[model samples]
Target: MTPPVPAADAPADRRRELRADCSACAGLCCVLPAFAASADFAIDKPAGRACVHLTPDAHCGIHADLRQRGFPGCTVFDCFGAGQRLVQVAAVERPVADPGVAAAFPVLRQLHELLWYLTEAAGLPLPAPLRAEVADLTGRTEALAAGGPAALAAVDAAAVRAGAGELLGRVSAAARPGGRDRRDADLVGAVLRGADLRRHGLRGAYLIGADLRGADLRGADLLGADLRGADLRGADLTGALFLTRPQVAAARGDGATRLPAALERPAHWGAAAPVRTRRPRRPGGRGGAAGR
Candidate 1:
């Protein structure tokens, strides 16, 4: 089974569990997961097989050019620090090409993701009762994660996620007072630029390809929201609830975009086109003095 959450003063490393540390990882993601030749991948590859783009040093050979080389999906994927943690827990001394590590990576990943969500939930400001429940659940989940590989393999991650979802729902409801319930709304390719979505309940909403430029998303609950291809230029997502790093990484944003405290601006965001402003015309006709 998975481990319980550590103490309140748990080691700093445990508290910052979701931050990806690729340098410390054994490239489990490049070798363990199966990929089909869809819009996401350039070719089909079986599970436990390393990608052709992976280098001898367990790094992606095309890391800097993934999107240009037909692997845009790779750019959005994140293991949430699970790859490195799994390597340590599984005692993986060999390269990621080892079938044993590949086979166990998926299970460990699921457990780690649960830890990530639970850790986030625990930090939310909820009612005393709800906060206590979240603490309890987080502890239990952390305990499961601390278990050995055999225990992790036997964990029911879906069930844990379901339970955590209930707690998170309550947390969302409490955080976003008077928010609209737009759960699972089909907003694909929407033209909602500059819209006021502050404090809205957008859990699991399909916002893919939506025009959200300059939108106000403060305090909005975005758990599980599909933000792929959404334009977030000049948008303010400050204090937005449950906005995962992967969701932000999948969307498009410019330098003017504001994010929640827990998240970081994705590196790809630096490539976004800069926002332009029109210069004001002179008070008088072109080449004429004002008030002439």
Candidate 2:
């Protein structure tokens, strides 16, 4: 047996940052994945079926030792704000266990993830032309986040994408000096640590070779954005609207990568880091068995 990797303790400040309103949820995240008996997972679970490792109270069995026990994937998965966006904001009153709720879960989950990116994007600098819209956009994002999952499921996705795209265009403009007409600007090879590109449009922009450590890409629209060779260490891509699957699939990352809601790290990235042991598993939660 692989010697158990001791869990790392989370820094107090960081723990406060990752804290979320999980109480408003019905534990949707733990049960929705397409699980199979693979190196990363010890069980085979179907879509819509709860994972065997999930306790009756809807918590992970292996809340600790995630990497050592072969469920490291859970540790790196960030719902960004998808869980709260759906369960608390959008689906406020409806219990996820309700008889009529099953059919929309998949779509709702994806939509909530998109919302997370957009909300994050809204914080970026806006062009003079779009600055006026940022306040309204921010308010709207907050409202949507507070809407329950059921409310989110009922939204028109196309409209949401369009709004996010508009915001991205504004961010792209602000990135340029003197507001140069850089609608097609190239940011490849730029060192952009902690740069705020929230809600900015970078559609079809070139971002290869950018060192985006701690960059805020929340709610920034990235449709057709070229991200080849971009370094996203510690970058928060949460709630970036219009970020397509292919764009994310094409981007590269390592252990330091942090994605927005509902997205998992690439299998090639290896297992998620072990949870810190300082934070003991919440009382009454169970740890996963070696195999299911």
Candidate 3:
């Protein structure tokens, strides 16, 4: 059995810098995606239109109280540094209305996400050949993302993503042999507390609202898993593969939740944290309710 790959220090730093730099960004996320009034959003926002809460200098007006104000989606949405990248590429004071900027934003966003995964995959304990392949792909994706808006628009992001996904699958299978295959399973709201899920294949699994508290998920391949609202308190995710920020941000993890070193714990998980080995009941009291 291949030993679990600890998150590599070099790549982990790269991944941290890969996340959204809101201060340098011009609130592209606030204007790029449409927000239909729903559970996550409180208003109907048209595509390409600046959100009502967006300040003139491109900051969210109600950032501190987004969830309480009925915009929980805003809390979990991460652009993976695409917003600032766009601003740098365009060099324009306002990028919200530029058709080229608008078109390039999404494609660059997807590429940057792939870059994140590829960066992590490159760090895994794979054979030399696979490692080389990961490096090659990373270099190519970086080159592609470095292009100006016109070059970015010319990119076929879907095709690139498809190839990357396939390669990543190979990397995961090779790195974590004998993992259970549960790709694309619909496990919404399933109670799976304290389960031994080591090396499981959970790619694209619908784990929405699933009770996974204290689950042993070490080495599980979680590529594209829909982790929205999943309870992850006390869970051991030290080496969970392909785990992305958006998935973790959408989930309900606590300070006790062990994540890959590359990931930042969602602030809503708590303002502070301490490692706890023991499993506790769905916590409450002074803390808000947990487990959906």
Candidate 4:
């Protein structure tokens, strides 16, 4: 039988519970993924080695100045609370965490990501059956995350993700009637300024460097959509679905960009895009007194 996921045993904020608490983590991310030197990362680091900037106590040496120190890539990385969960649940003690943790972190991260999505989906006005499905899947996913490292290592994470994706697709369809579907489209650097893209399905779309200034993106489904350097000045994203912090932080959005209440305006973005308003012309014609 699957074990119940560990919780705080009292009323708590699920959103906060699902977020990264690096203080509680063992710095799993610093040692897990290989880093390629690029615009995002300053150095190429091999996997399974602690980052050069990682402190003895599992803290980042350049936490406040990561971007300035050439590690902007680390700024947007979130494990959705996986690292800490492993530290707490597995009782990992480290100068080096157990090899099992290295093996299990990726699997646990994926499960935790699914949990984040399911939690958001539950809040949407899904139908009764869909709501129940979300609840069931959420429970199952929690059970998967609750397991020991052995069980986590044995899980077919991709298969579980595929199942969850299918369910999310159905949920998206129900929630977005007659929305345009653009799943997995390579729309890199496309100019879509001032477009009406409400309720559009853009799952897994490559929107890299796209110009999206002043676009209306209300209720758009942006699951796994890459928004790296995408311009979102004055774009309205109210009610957009499945839009995560990393995605928002990667994109360029000014204060005028209307984000969903759940997300914060990225600090890097400019204060506000210039607002344009048309001046009313006098009925007389062009260059009339009012127009002047």
Candidate 5:
């Protein structure tokens, strides 16, 4: 039997930085963003309007059955804990119907996404010099996030993203030396099942709807890779660098898929069998007859 590989564990601060805390949030994602009728959404909603599925208590009415209710897009969308922070910044206790708050959502979302990447970069095993640089970047971004709505809205988001992207690019290069430079490659609908992509640099690659089943992706850098609708069933992503929860959520996978430790298996991935232990089974055991 293969030894169980430990899932990637993020530092607590970084984990909190990346994961959504909906209870503390004001249902900003449901109210602030617009949606159009598509495969991902069942109806069209204008910005500043609460989603039809949003309940009175700021919970998703179909939270447990989002995918079954034609809202897989909601399942895949993550604000990296930005929604709550935006609510706090705006001083609102619950979902606000104000247009200004709605307008600031996109900007704050981008800033928080930057914070997510920078926070992740800080936790990487980079050289001391690079680590210090990452820390500085993270601090600057956090300061910007702490600024209220007006300051956040005033930010040049595009310029900030570009600057942070450069630093993250260096971090990716240092982490995965000699990896393939496949950034922004258009591989949509490409059939790459069972390909050996170990240690490849796939940053910003457009892999929409790509068939990656059973592929070997060990140690590959997947930063900013567009994995939406990509088939990752049974793919070995052990040691994959820069793979985020949002990226994994956007892709389709199965129980056999191997993922890094930091990400949870998407619920859409069918139920996985419980891991077996080394203990021998007792006589007439529920699992088997005396370890047959």
Candidate 6:
């Protein structure tokens, strides 16, 4: 049976910074990224090519009606400045060039992903040691942002990741709930093997590394929640609402697991039941491609 998606459980105070402040950016994400066919993306797009729906000024052409037009994936992507940083400093000469112009685009993508995680870290509670680490990394990342493309390309990604990882480990440890606190709390890594957490308010909670091997999370609210590293080996998330596909991709589930209707099981978790498939034919056939 198809399970219902959980309602959002994220708190109002826990709002993510959309960084719309980045509007001044040259629309690097719109011009330099690639996407394949998936639940989130309805069509394929080549790198550096402006999404067919992207406007001359780099705004989404369908900005006023994305969901109505079946382009929800655009809503979930977060660039974290990788696109802008690359374009401004790395390829300053290119004017809205193709996605392939920046050799460091891939590297920038990784850094931006890291930045996403670190940005979330800025909000979590942390110990003094971890907090200190977060401050240092945040400062360094900010400095790197101010540094031009050459400096960004010269960044040691591994070292930055290590520092972020250390701080994240601490944040996860500190954020974990204990004993009955686990009864209705967000357990990022609580070692619960068979807990029942159904119909609870888990909005915006962290479930990373939680041992939900046999837990029951059916009918739970999971809006805007982060479930990375969560183990859903034999757990039930059936009928959980508002659990987006990208959120599902971030978790680890197994064959015995149950998922919400709108999401597909992560490949690492096992082959999920196929929901839909189409012939290799493009959406519009060979004549011409559809707009983004």
Candidate that would win on lDDT:
3
Candidate 6 C-alpha lDDT tens digits along 1-292: 3332222333333223222223555666666777886765667888767778776666677766664577656654555445555656655433365434344555555565655555555554455556567657767766665565555557776687667655654544444333122223566788878888766556567777778788887756565567766777788888664455566656677888888643556555677544333346567656323322
lDDT of 3 at 44: 100
Rank all candidate structures by their lDDT, best first, as comma-separated numbers. 3, 4, 5, 1, 6, 2
- For model 6 the TM-score comes to 0.50
Q: Give the TM-score comparing model 2 with the true structure, all chains together.
A: 0.49
> Against the hidden reference, what TM-scores do the models get?
0.85, 0.49, 0.89, 0.87, 0.87, 0.50
Off by over 4 Å in 6: 1-18, 81-95, 98-125, 156-159, 177-292
- 1 or 4, greater by TM-score: 4
Among these predictions, the greatest TM-score belongs to 3
TM-score of 4: 0.87
Stretches of candidate 5 off by over 4 Å are 1-10, 273-292
lDDT of 3 by residue, 184-279 (tens): 999999999999999999999999999999999999999999999999998899899999888998999887899987888888897436653444
For residues 1-292, write the lDDT of model 1, one tens digit per residue: 3333333432356547767787888778888788999888999988878899888787889898998899988888888777788778877653565655664566666666767666666666566777688779878877877776667767777888888888889878876789888999999999999999999999999999999999999989998999999999889999898888889989999888989766778887875345455555676646434323
Model 5 lDDT per residue over 14-127, tens place? 667657888888898998888999999989999788998888889898899988888888988888887888888788877777767766677777878887677667666677
How high is the lDDT of residue 142 in model 1?
Answer: 72
lDDT of 2 by residue, 1-292 (tens): 2232232332344223223445555666665556777755766767667766667665666766676788655554555435554554345342344422443455454444444444333444444345446546656655654445456457666676577666655544453324223235688888888898776666677887788877887756565677756777667787554464445644566666656544556655555555333444546766444311
Listed per model in order, the count of residue pairs whose N, CA or C atoms clash below 3 Å is 15, 38, 0, 0, 3, 14
Candidates 1 and 3: which is better by TM-score?
3
Model 4 C-alpha lDDT per residue in residues 1-292, reported as the tens digit of each score:
3332322222237778778899998788998788999989999988888889899898989988887888878888888888898888788655354678877889998998888788778777666777789889999999999998888989999999999999999878877889999999998999999999999999999999999999999999999999988999889999898888889988888879988766667677756556456678757768645456
Arranged by TM-score, best first: 3, 5, 4, 1, 6, 2
